[model samples]
Target: MAGRKITKKVVKFLKLYYFFLFNIFKLNYVLNKQYKIIFLLLIPNKHNTPPTQAFKKLLNVQIVLNIYIKEHLGGVIHELFYSRNS
Candidate 1:
């Protein structure tokens, strides 16, 4: 139980910390393409890899997609990723 509590805290901090990091990397790596292309190209790859690695690779894209999807899919954005959840 104590370990679970500590893990939750760490995950939360990592989420806030890494979100901006992913955006920065996205701007660095994901620039100048239409969101359609990005969405099509990257999401499959994101799905294939393990979560920890995919988190690093796909975090920014996920954030961007959430902007579009949250309009239609409702709470999926909240449920789709691992973040600091208590």
Candidate 2:
């Protein structure tokens, strides 16, 4: 009877150990998959190339034009409202 009890305890301990081991392996696989996805997203592909020098210059010109237009419009409105004629 004592030997039977010892065998039962060993079996139970092995079951618990294997259960935890399987779960750990599953978690590791899931984390590795997520890491691979994140790494792929972070790497710039051909479709996501950085802007070229010409594009950067064009963007700068657009920004400057936007600023100039806003300032010019503000000046025109100011003159219309605060002029000596009004």
Leading candidate by TM-score? 2
> What CA RMSD would you report for each candidate?
15.5, 30.7
* Model 1 alpha-carbon drift over 4 Å, by segment: 22-86
Per-residue lDDT tens digits for candidate 2, residues 16-55, read 5566566655655665566556645655556666647445
What is the TM-score of candidate 2? Answer: 0.37
Q: Report the Cα lDDT for residue 38, model 1.
A: 60
The true-versus-predicted C-alpha distance at residue 57 of model 1, in Å, is 37
> Candidate 2: where is the Cα deviation over 4 Å?
1-51, 84-86
Pairs with backbone N, CA or C atoms under 3 Å apart (clashes), candidate 1: 12-84
> What does the lDDT read for residue 53 in candidate 1?
66
The C-alpha TM-scores of every prediction are 0.25, 0.37
lDDT of 2 at 86: 42
Compose the digit string of candidate 1's lDDT tens values, residues 27-59: 544442455466557655555667666455556
Top candidate by lDDT: 2
